[model samples]
Target: MTAKVSYLISKPVVTINKGTHSIDAAKKMAEHNIGSLIIMDNEKLIGIITERDIIRALGKGISLDLPVEEIGTTKNLITINENDSIYKAAELMAKNNIRHLIVTNNDGKLVGIISIRDLIRESHVLKALSVTSEQEWIGSD
Candidate 1:
């Protein structure tokens, strides 16, 4: 059985306003033990800032005091519905070279986020189940 994106998204999605400082955002991420934050603007999902974005901004000499919007990925915000298969999410991530994906409800509202780590965990679970099933079959007369 294929797992859905809903199975991977963490609850009560962590979000930050677009005007939030990069340093502050990083602090929030650390406090929450998360890698990314959904960027909001006027009660709308505008973009996302991830650890990778922060690293890139620092490497480029961008000021951490600047708003996260200035360094965040705004264009082409990749998203998938909550019911979409995890395989599809994996494909989207691989194609976009992104470690995270925003999940939206049917009404097009931000619901949650999924990370590559979540996908890897799900893959491991599936693989273990497959191995167990195969072993059972082999052992059966």
Candidate 2:
């Protein structure tokens, strides 16, 4: 069976308000040990913040004390449905040059989040599952 984005979901997607200080966003990411944080406003998913965003801000000498959005948080968030194929998720990420993705439900509500690392890990599982045994391998000397 082909894997789906739902299979890659890590529960309880972390989030932050757009107005939160950039430094606070960084700290929140560190606390969660996550690379990105979803940005929600009025119970609506808006955008996302990542370590790279913070890095860019620092490189530009932007104050970490400023609102995270001021750091130019990703305005266009690329999302995938939880039931969508994992291959689709990977394709979107590669096409967009992004490392993270938000998983939404049928109602377009945040269900979870997935990262490139998750896809890589899932790929290994798929590979292992594909090779049931060495005898099943297609290659031969």
Candidate 3:
């Protein structure tokens, strides 16, 4: 069976609104022990804020007091359908040179996200299952 990217999407996506301060976004990430947050405006998906984004902002001497919408990587955001295969998610990530992907439903509504880590973990699980099946088949011979 082909595993779907939806399987890796976590609910409620940990969002931050458009005008939130950059510092607050960093704090939210810290509080959630997560590396990223979905940026929203009036409940609409706008962009994404990640640990790297904050680190880059700070390194560039950007003020934390600025709105997260300004600091976030809002332009050219890459997204994927939640029902796509995990392999497709990984391929998209690779093609876009991104570590995270905003996941949407068939109606183009934000539902969740997929990350490189999720893909890695799923791949490991699939590899384990494949190895187990191979062992079983050999043992039956």
Candidate 4:
């Protein structure tokens, strides 16, 4: 059975509006202990600004005082529905080489987020189980 995205997306999301400054986004990122925030406007999922975006903006000498829309990846967005499978969500991340994904509702409102680290943590648990299983098999044999 495919794991549902509802089990993976981070809830009670921290979001930013297009009018918000890059500095504000960075501050929220740190305060929320998250690497990215879903950008919204009028309760609609718009864009996303990640830690990498903030760093790249700084590298280009862009002012933090500028709006997040100035630095956010607005050109190509990848969003997933709430009921999608975890495998599909992971596939999207692998294909896009992104660590985070925006979770949207039927109306495309920002709902939550999922991260590559979340998937990695799951993989780690499975690896531990696999190791234990192998150990038991060896001992029994």
Candidate 5:
């Protein structure tokens, strides 16, 4: 059986206001132990800022004090529905070359976020279970 993205929505959504500075956004992410923050404007989802965006900013010599929206992944925000299958999520991530995906509900409301790490952890569990089942079958044969 395939797992739904909802099964991995264990954490609360960490968000930052759009006008927030890069340094502040980074601080929020660090404080929450998250890799990305949903950028909002007046309680509306506007974009997202990730560790990669901050690093890119540093590489370009951009001031960290600048608003995160200036460097956030805004133009083409990649997102997935919470009810989607994990396999679909993985395909979307690979297709877009993204490490994180914003998870929303059928109504398009923000729900949670999923990362490559999350998918890998789930995969490890599934692999272990499969191996254990195979071992049991072989032993019983």
Candidate 6:
């Protein structure tokens, strides 16, 4: 059976308010061994912060005390619903060339996160299928 996004996404998402400091968010990411964190306010989706955001702040010499909103990428947050298939999620990742996606509930509340690593892990199963198909093709030929 094809895997689904829900199967791979990390739930009980660690989130932050946009007002929270980038350093604080970075600390949470490190503590959780996660690459990204959802930014929200009163249960509404707002933005996202990631390790990359923290790096960019360092590059700009921005203070660690600065709010994550000041360093986070605000535009083009790619989100997915829990019910969406992994196929669709993978397509979105390829289209956006992004490594992570924020998963949302039916009411659009942040629920979890999925990453390319999750999809690539699934590819191993698909690879096994491909090998089987290739062997079958060779035998037929």
Better of 1 and 2 by TM-score: 1
Instruction: Give the TM-scores of the predictions, in the order they appear.
Output: 0.85, 0.83, 0.84, 0.82, 0.85, 0.79
A best-first ranking of the candidates according to their lDDT comes to 1, 5, 3, 2, 4, 6
Q: Is candidate 3 or candidate 5 better by TM-score?
A: 5
Question: Over the stretch 1-74, how does candidate 1's per-residue lDDT look in tens digits?
Answer: 66788999755789999889999999999999999999999789999999999999899998999898888888
- Model 2 C-alpha lDDT versus the unseen true structure: 0.83
For candidate 2, write residues 17-57 as lDDT tens digits: 87888899999999989998888786988888899889988
Best of the two (2, 4) by lDDT:
2
Go through the candidates in order and give the clash count of each. Answer: 0, 0, 0, 0, 0, 0
lDDT of each: 0.89, 0.83, 0.86, 0.82, 0.87, 0.81
lDDT per residue for candidate 3 within 18-128, as digits (tens), equals: 999999999999998888899998878999998888999999999999998888888988988888878778778878788888999998888998778888888644675
Model 6 lDDT per residue over 56-78, tens place: 78998889898887788678788
Q: Which stretches of candidate 4 lie over 4 Å from their true place?
A: 123-141
| Pairs clashing within candidate 4 | none
Q: Which digits, one per residue and each the tens of the lDDT, describe model 4 over residues 1-141?
A: 656777876557888988899999999999988899877776767789999999998999989998887888776899889888777777799799998988878877767888888777676435555776799999997
Measured over all alpha carbons after superposition, the RMSD of each candidate to the real structure, in angstroms, is 5.6, 4.7, 5.8, 5.6, 5.7, 4.5
Residue 9, model 5, lDDT: 76
Against the true structure, candidate 5 reaches a TM-score of 0.85
Top-scoring candidate (lDDT):
1
Clashing residue pairs in candidate 3 are none
After superposing candidate 2 on the true structure, give the runs of residues whose Cα lies further than 4 Å from its correct spot: 72-74, 124-141
Instruction: Estimate the lDDT of model 6.
Output: 0.81
After superposition, the stretches of candidate 3 with alpha carbons farther than 4 Å from their true spots are 124-141
Q: Which order, best to worst by TM-score?
A: 5, 1, 3, 2, 4, 6
